[model samples]
Target: MEAEYDVAVVGAGPAGATAALVLARSGFRVALIESTRYERSRPGETLPPPARMLLARLGVWDAFSTLGSLPSHGNRSIWGGPEIAESSFIFHPYGEGWHVDRQRFDAMLASTAADAGAEVLYGMSVVDCSAPDADRWHIGLRGESGEAGTMAARAIVDATGRTARIARRLGATRQLADHLVGAAVHYAGPLREDGFTLVEAASSGWWYSAPVPPDRLVVMFMSDADIHRSLRLTEGDRWEHLLAEAPHTMERVEGCRPIAQPAFFAAVSHRLRRNGARGCWLACGDAAIGVDPLSSSGIVRAIRTGEGAGQAIGNWLLGRTDVAGAYERILDAEFEEYMAERSGYYALETRWPHSTFWNRRRTIDAAMRQQP
Candidate 1:
């Protein structure tokens, strides 16, 4: 017989892990499925300071804090102007932010979920999900050793990052504003700028460089997918040529040797038409709304949405109603606020009015304005 769960949360990142942890704590049998085993590299390692309270609320704060994550004091950027600028996190109630080891951070979340009583299935791929009726979701799974299994759940939460794999399988279409990609390269050297992150803009795109931990920094170029392909960033000379366009960024990366081949990440700024409320399922994290890296809200947002979904789903499973309504209202408000701020920020980069990258940003804003 197939295993059954009150909720089967897919993609055990921040959102899924939190969802599982919460559900398990609420006395529900939850199954958390994750494809990656967190053995390799992934991006989006930075988290704002406010996330501490969220982790604390979820009861995983002490474990996460003990991971020796690098503390980030603030950010120094040349964004919106030629001269460099600084924004300190000290103003926030929470002291310093963190640039975490993303792989380990994710592992910690998964481990915590398992300890909390959720069946944390790592290195497992969810092949598909079917809703035979209002009663349950039948999920197909494949194990790491090429073994196959099936599980049933009363509810599903798609926290699969921007992929929205499970939600899309159920007919949800992603709404996109622009095509964005991040090409990153890890660098190892002396900690040149200890506590502050760096952002510098160029004619084609922007650059983000931040110290991760111990003795390493990760620098990445942000641009549209087509633009990145056009520039042939895979080639060292071409990558360095565009990188040098930002003199300030060049200075930060100085003396740092590239420790890995350039890595690419999908940074597309987007959201879904309506987050999953169909057949007792909800989408969280980037699966629900994918914002740009410029906001630096990805991890925090993921954890927040996970908590909200967990609570809302818990309420519904226990005989409460309109969980989806509350979930939708909260996420919609966040999306609107983020879009407004994004528009204002992009408008500040008028220096690159003729640049293809800037043009795309403007076009996206103009389209949003035309929306009814």
Candidate 2:
């Protein structure tokens, strides 16, 4: 007989773990599956105020806050025209944010799910999933030992980030925008300890810098994928050389060493037409909708979406159909907000370059926009 669970969350990142934690604590049998075992993951160590509020409500903020992470006062932008004025979020009353330790943060989220009675399984990749019935799901997973296993669940949630494995297999077509590509690297020490967002204007694209830990920062240049591809293919070391041009980033990391290899990805804004629910499956996080990386709202959106999915699944399990409709509405609202915010930001940048990366982003259509 195949093992069964009330909820099976795929991809133990922020979204999956949050859903598992919420459901498990509410007395639902939950299985949190992850492909990569967490060991110092890099991306998304910063949490804005909205996300911090969610963490607090979930009862895990204390654990994350005490982990030597710095609070982010606000974000900074250096786009527009000739002169740049730096503004801090402290101008607002609440004044909240965080620069996190991703390794510890992700592990804690997963551990909390397990502590709340969820079965946390690392190194388990979901290879396939299907609807067993109108309200039941069956999923196939490949274990680290090269073994295949199956599990039956009332609902399946996909939090697979950009990969969108389940969405693709389910025949969900996506609309991808090719305006931005990202390349990032982490550095150690002598950098700004207080968290801040730094932006710089460049001919090819724009550069972003953020403090990750006490003395380390993550710096990435985002623009057209062709720009990065050409740099890596033709100029080779040109990417690293360009980092030296960012005023704020270069000053802090004058003599720092990289903790990990520079990673690059073609950033795009896309979303599935339907986030499942034909039977007993749903998708969350990047699997459902993805926006431009420049917004830094992906992690927050993931947690929020997962929470809604968990709630909907809980209601459906109790034979409540109305709850699922509400969940779909929430998804639409959230995605639209994300798209608008990113579109506005890109619009601000477009005034600088006539037909460069900024122009493409500024002229984006309504479909390209998503809410947070």
Candidate 3:
């Protein structure tokens, strides 16, 4: 007979793994489902000081601490002005920020959850999911090798990132923002001892670069999809031309050659109409709220929501009726605060007031005032 877990968390990314970790540690039977095994390279390598505290509380910081991630002092940015300004993490209680190997770092989180007693199904894709009864769900699974099976769970946690695939299947909708894309390129150069991320603004878009593990740099250009296409930023000289506009980034890449051609994809931000339902099932992390990467708080947001949801689900299943309502209220407040902060950050770059991206962003705060 297939074992019916107390909670089945889909997508073993930071959120799902953290949820599974928290639930398992609390003595709940959890099945951590993941489609990919975290083998490919991923962006968003910078971890700010506040995130470190969350990781420590989640009990996964030790695994990350041993990885020898680059110690990031702070950030130097050219946003809102021509002059560069440097902010220091030295002020934060956490002291230093660490740039890490995203792929390896994420895998370690999954491993930690497994070690904590969650049954992690690596490389297993959830093909289908359905509520078998009022209190349980029937989950269809398929392995990478093509084998298939079924499992059951008392509750489900959708940590599948932006798409909220599982939650959508269960009757949720999404609210999308303007088309946004981020083009990335990895560069290598002489070893630098100081660790500080760099950010610069341009009329068409904004640029951000940070150091990751193993002495390497990751540079990304974020802009609207229409602007990127219209400006032809992908072409050979044009791509380099934009980088040159950002002095700090351009200087560091003096002798460095591109590891590969620039790659761009949808960085669209969205949020679910309802984060989770009244039942024990819940949607947390990006699956619940997808934010713009400019915030550099995705990892922390994922961990926070995942851990919060795990406890909420545990209590709700154990017969607490008010936990579900409280959970929604908490997420609602957080989302409102996030939108306010997001608007303030985007407004900092008014250098291109007439630009489509900037104009839309400036008015975004008004548009976001209404909740769906």
Candidate 4:
């Protein structure tokens, strides 16, 4: 007999875990699948204040706060004119935030889902999925031991971050535009005792330095990879060069040594088409609509979507599919609001020196006009 669950969540990251926790706590049987066997630390450590509120709602606030996560005040990305120019300063308010240990933070959230009574299967790979009918989905997953199995669920939630695994399986084309790419490394540092600092380097791109723990800090840079072309450098060399160009950034890292190799990924500005279409599935987090990390809204948005999806899916499992419809409506509205805000921020980047990097992002507003 095929395994059956009231709800099947693919990807046990923040969104999926939160969704699973919500459903399980409410007495619904849930199955959550995670692709990786081990959790690893990553950048995007700072969470906006709004996200902290969501985390509190999920009951993980105390655990997170006690983990030595640094408190975040706000974010400073290049807004208007040149970096040195007074007109260039535009501080976006993030309110109360935290720079967390992502690996631990994510694992803790997923474990909460288990503690709440959801069956979480880590190291399981989702191979395929299908909507057999309007009311159910059939999912195939490969276990860590290489055994393949199938699961049936009333609904599926995709929280696969940027991979959009299920979206691609459905042949959904992703809209990718060159905006910025991110490279980061964690190190010991002359940590900013106050909060995070994001500096716009004249040529190398933007750099972010912040405290994560008393002894360790995370530093990252974002720029158009097509222009920087530093993507080709070996990890160690790349990090050294990044440090060399941003002297102000270096001052913060004065006595620190790298804790890990530098890492980079294309930070393209893109969103999936038909976030919810044929299947009883809803995409959350970077899986649905991705905004610039410059906005520092990624983690907050993920938690919010998780909360929204949980409420929506709970209603659907109880035979109120109309609640799912309402969820999609709210998601669409939120996406529009976020895009508008992000576009305004991107536009501000153009008012500065017109380099290929800023110019490329400048067209985002015009491009979003054709997003239909």
- Highest-lDDT candidate: 1
By TM-score, how accurate is candidate 2?
0.90
lDDT of each: 0.87, 0.75, 0.83, 0.73
Q: What is the lDDT of residue 53 in candidate 3?
A: 83
Q: How well is each residue in 1-372 modelled by candidate 4, as lDDT tens digits?
A: 998998888888777888889889999889989988545665567777667667777888786766777777655544455353221112534356777777877888888899999999899988999886767788999987899988999888888877788877866656765556777777874554656546554453667776776567677778887655735544447567656766666777777788776677656666767644665677777776676776777777777788788778888777777876777678667777877786776565544465666665557566776877
Clashes of each: 0, 11, 0, 1
Least accurate stretch of 10 residues (summed lDDT) in model 1? 269-278
Candidate 1 lDDT, 188-208, residue by residue in tens: 876586777888888888999
Pairs in steric clash, model 4: 188-256
Cα lDDT of model 3 by residue, 286-325, tens digit: 8888878887788888889999888998897799968867
Give the TM-score of each candidate.
0.97, 0.90, 0.94, 0.87
RMSD of each: 1.4, 2.8, 1.9, 3.5
Better of 2 and 3 by lDDT: 3
Candidate 4 total steric clashes: 1
lDDT of 2 by residue, 1-372 (tens): 998999889988888898888788789999999987886455766677777678888898887777787788777766765455566767655567777777777888888889899998899999988884756778999998989999988887878877778767776656565646678878886664556777776667888778876567887888787767766722556756877656766665777777766687656777666534376556777777777766778788888887877777777778887876777677767767776777776666545565566666655654354322
Model 4 ranges with Cα > 4 A deviation: 76-95, 177-179, 189-192, 228-231, 235-238, 350-354
Q: Mark the regions of model 1 whose C-alpha exceeds 4 Å error after superposition.
A: 275-277
Task: Candidate 3: give the clashing pairs.
Answer: none
Model 3, C-alpha of 363: deviation from truth (Å): 2.4
Candidate 2 ranges with C-alpha deviation above 4 Å: 233-235, 275-277, 351-355, 366-372
lDDT of 3 at 139: 93
